[model samples]
Target: MTTPTPVVFIHGLWLHATSWEPWIDLFQKEGYDASAPGWPGDPDTVEEARANPESIADHGIDAVVDHYASIIKDLPVAPILIGHSFGGMIAQKLLGQNLAAAAVAIDAAQIKGVLPLPLSALRATLPVFKNPANKHRAVSLTAEQFRYAFGNALSAEESDALYERWTIPAPGKPLFEAAAANFNPHSPAKVDTANELRGPLLLMTGGKDHTVPEAVTRATLKQYRHSEAVTDILDFPDRGHSLTIDGRWREVADTALDWLRRQEL
Candidate 1:
């Protein structure tokens, strides 16, 4: 029997591993081992996270990346890493360690070399960094806030339900890190995977994404221009930063799966 490749999914901020249930299911059905690792002390459900936002306050990029690194160390084989938003940043970090067979970063946050910050991305993150006290706290978004940041292109009912099911308080420190990434010379979020020859890397962008705009995605592509292995980029014109959770998530998932199949992994 042929061995299956394992896939580790890292969710974006304000979301737990459970948020990737649909993607996980699709991956499993395709004969792959898939796991979604939660941030430290993440509550099991959205309701629980909403009720006790403080539990996620201590999770920063370093801690979260280290948690996944440990998981990869114990895996039977190096797995494909897939992440979105903050999770996308984590995926880039993992790829730099040469720990994965492949990786896909969807609307990932800014790292060291990529410097374009659209107004929409700034506005989406303003709630977390607006207050000094928020540095060590978890901040949840109101419905209106969620609508603008995550559901701008979806229907009202879909937007409302997504907010109810997936929105939660996220750690503030990662936002701070992303905000200051360009200024930090030694930041791990800065990935140098251009020399990695073992696996292909894919960077995807949501064309309508205010959180991580197409311009930023193009910048990321340029940074990886020196990669020895093939580097590719995909743009979903109708999707937003919440493409993984919004109405068209399946389409995005299928796109990634298609890429994986082409690699025959």
Candidate 2:
């Protein structure tokens, strides 16, 4: 029997790849090889990551994308890509380059063509943007900020628990890089939406997400309407940026799993 295609889960800022463990386990149980790789220099655990936030601080979107692309290149078969937040943006980039068989981007960071820069989005990024020096530093969020950006849909207790387990510092460069990508001639935030080989792309949005809200994800979908590939959007009405790690994470995973099964992958 042929081996199932590998599934790669990319993580966003302020969280390491381990946050995908539940999803990885679910996918593995479904007979797919799954992995969630860290950005270069990521620590082994959240505690270690918090202690050594600077380890992955300097790597930008280009660096992180190249890291995952290299991993996919070494796999035995073309992989399905699933990413959250910045990982979502990275997933789209890989798909555009013909690297993935399919992709699911959840609450993804803005790309070049996305136009709604909501005020909530700006507040969510204040930890990094409030300090110009953060461009070269790793930025960590306070519990309040995390609640606002990621756990807005969860109760206070639930949000606190998640913060203790999954939250960490993130490199500021990628956010800065992607924010200016539309105008930067040398920006690494570009994607070739016209690629016929981009396969199927799905952008998942959260109704309660402050960081990458529905408007942002919808705009991303509109950009891909020009692509020859099949592009779609799925919105979780009661979710937030923490959709993948929250109590109803299984619901999100089930939706993605069902979508993949429909694609016969």
Candidate 3:
């Protein structure tokens, strides 16, 4: 019997591993083994995460990245790494260490080549960076906030429901780190994905996403220009940063699945 390819999913900030439940189901049906590693102390459910937001306060990029890296180390076989937003940065970091069979970064957070800081992105992150006290706290989004930053392109009911189900307080430090990434020489947000010769790397962007705009994604793609292996970019016109949870999530997952199948994993 052929061995199944392992798939590791890393969710973006304010979300836990459960955020990938639907995608995990789809991957399993396709004969793949999947695991969604939580950021340190991430609660299993949105309600629980909200109830204990303080637990996530110390989960900075380096800590979260190392936690996932440790999980990868114990895997019997190298797995395909898939991540979104901050999780994307972690995926790239893992790829840099040469740990995955392949990787897909979706609406990934600030990384090398993504230098633009659109006002909307700033506004979306303001709630976290408005005060120095937030640096060590967890910031939860209000319904209106989630609507603007995550579900802007979805229907009201769908957006509201997603907020209720997936919204949770996220560590503030990572957002601050991403905001200062370009200027900080020692930012943990930095990743040298240009060494793409390691394996197939796919960067997926949500065209209508205000948080991680298409322009930013395009800039990031340029960094991989010198990669030896396949480096590809795909944009979903109608999707927002919340593409993984909003309506039509299955469509986005299928698109990624198609790409994963082509990799011969």
Listed per model in order, the count of residue pairs whose N, CA or C atoms clash below 3 Å is 0, 0, 0
Q: Which numbered prediction scores highest in TM-score against the true structure?
A: 2
Estimate candidate 2's alpha-carbon lDDT, on a 0 to 1 scale.
Answer: 0.90
Over 1-265, each residue of candidate 2 has an lDDT whose tens digit, in order, gives 9887899999999987899999999999999999998888899899999998779788899898899999999999889999999999999999988899999999999888677899999999998998888998999998899999999999989998999899989999998998898888777888777787677988899999999989999988888876777887889999999999999999999999888877777
**Model 1 agreement with the true structure over 100-188: per-residue lDDT tens digits:** 99889999887778888889988988888789788799998888788778788788788889888888899998888777877888775
Cα lDDT for residue 263, candidate 3: 82
Worst 10 residues of 3 by lDDT: 190-199
The per-prediction CA RMSD against the true structure, in angstroms, equals 1.3, 0.9, 1.3
lDDT of 3 at 225: 76
Q: What would the TM-scores of all predictions be?
A: 0.96, 0.98, 0.96
Model 1, 244: alpha-carbon shift in Å? 0.8
Worst 10 residues of 1 by lDDT: 189-198
lDDT of each: 0.85, 0.90, 0.85
Over 4 Å off, model 2: none
Could you tell me the TM-score of candidate 2? 0.98
For model 3, residues 30-51, the per-residue Cα lDDT tens digits are 9999879789989777778889
